[model samples]
Target: MATAGNISFIPLTFILSGIPELGNNQNWFAFPLGALYVIALVGNVTILFLINREDSLHQPMYFLLSMLAFTDIGVSLTTLPTMLSIFWFNYTQIYLQSCLTQMYFLHTFAAMESGVLVAMAVDRLIAICDPLRYAAILTNSVIAKMGLLILLRGLCVVFPVPFLTRRFPFCKTHMLVHSYCLHQDVIRLACADTTVNSIYGLVAVLLTKGIDSLFIIISYGMIFRAVLRIKANEARLKAFSTCISHICAVLVFYVPLIGLSVVHRFGKHASALLPVFMADIYLLVPPVINPVIYSIKTKQIRAKVIKLFRRREIGARDNVIATI
Candidate 1:
């Protein structure tokens, strides 16, 4: 059986300085990574709150957007500090329990993100293809039910990662290739036997995340087909513009995602750097761009954003005058 070897790396200074005593013994990536992840958490939490409170965002699409934001927050929480810990302190010795816990949350959040995207695709299909029933069919209660289904489905799909990974024996080479304890990579460290875990991992991925992406592709394909049938260029243009932001979001999420799992399964250090950069881009780009994307693409949302900003500016001016 193979488990990760204890690897060492360049420790981050700020993290080392934070807890001076453990700086020598413990991994020193806590401070900067903690800052970055906290920022990400705050931004995503803001988006979730805005999407929840704004009346304009009452639609099914925005509901799913909030869910996506929640998933991103979970993902960043699960991966960021661990990754920085691995990179800054080269501490790859995850205990049996901690490794499995990371695998579970990592997979759970991954599934949740995919599940929300699939729901968004389905919502788009209804809105575009059949507008009349959109409101009645996607009512608040119905949306809640869909959310429940998404969570249930994600839970069912990812339940195996931890169980399967835990059963394996680790003789040597437990050093995870990627920064975090990805499902496949953690399983690879099992020493005793892992053929079953490998098979199940593939199944879980295919059934959940892969299937969701496949259906999203199908949804877009149908949208493109419908676009072709529309005789009015202006109508087609509006429909195309609406979907563009979602397409861009999906691309940013899915492209480099498979790399982490793929590289860790068969080899080591093969795509470590690629996955590291991609991991940062995957989590960072979406939250950074989501607000801007909606503000630019949707007229009503843009108005709300502008109104909020104008209110803030007026308040600031009033405060300055009051002080004078």
Candidate 2:
């Protein structure tokens, strides 16, 4: 704790404000939030299982997708404990060290997700623009290296945040805006100068998400140019169709992300619930939606999922007959 003109501040624990509008009725949100968590967990796990079980999916594209599934799971798991505690149990107090740990994983997973998306964009660019070299360029070894680089980049970039956040003395008002700890939200509670933390946070976001988005856009531009060059309309349409799932994934991840950032940075006068809602959407929607989009848009995944269920049905019927 620290002193500011006879006032004691900087409590060891922070209180989470879970949907201030709901107040005592916050428990009502537990059902929907729990449902979303279940969907995200089941969906991403199913994608990973399908990708792993199918030998035909042992390709660079599917490999990147598996990485995305892992990242989504990380995102979902990072916030689940705190969100559940706040909504279900009304347990909102979080220790300083614990908050920092949550902030680290949350930001790290987010950065890693952005990195995976950029890698996916590059994968698509090579596949569409230079089909002959796609196999040569994105070998298993190369993909493995890319995955390592993404992990390392996330680790290095987010490693400083906890330390930076720990240096500040927080104000007496220990209430946080959301159920889970966030760098931006935590920094705002500091009574001391937070310029360094703020600038570093912005830099981290720019270096990761901003650069990743730019690269994705450029890759898509190249893909479009290559697709347009195909003389046959059918071939052009086929090439374009392959990107639909990825496009949807990108939009799902980035749109809510951008909205949340905008609300945090510029929407000072906006409803308190708006930022909270945006944050929830940003974190929850992608995990629940990405696997669904891929399953629906990618024929191979859809077919495999259908085949898996059919086999399960057959096995159940066989067991029933044997028992009878």
Which candidate should be chosen as best, given lDDT against the real structure? 2
Candidate 2: segments with Cα more than 4 A from true spot: 1-10
lDDT digits (tens) for residues 235-267 of candidate 1 = 988877778768776776787576545545454
Worst 10 residues of 1 by lDDT: 8-17
Name the lDDT value of residue 42 in candidate 1: 67
- The global C-alpha lDDT for each of the candidates, from Candidate 1 onward, is 0.69, 0.93
Instruction: Please provide, for model 2 over 1-324, each residue's C-alpha lDDT reduced to its tens digit, 9 standing for 90 to 100.
Output: 667763345568989999999888889899999999999999999999999999999999999999999999999999998999999999999988899999999999999999999999999999999899999999999999999999999999999999998888776688899889999999888878999998999999999999999999999999999999999999999999999999999999899899999999999999999999999888999999999999999999999989989999999999999999
Instruction: Give the Cα error of residue 307 in candidate 1, in Å.
Output: 3.1
Clashes of each: 13, 0
Residue 33 lDDT in model 2? 91
TM-score of each: 0.81, 0.96
| lDDT value for model 2 | 0.93
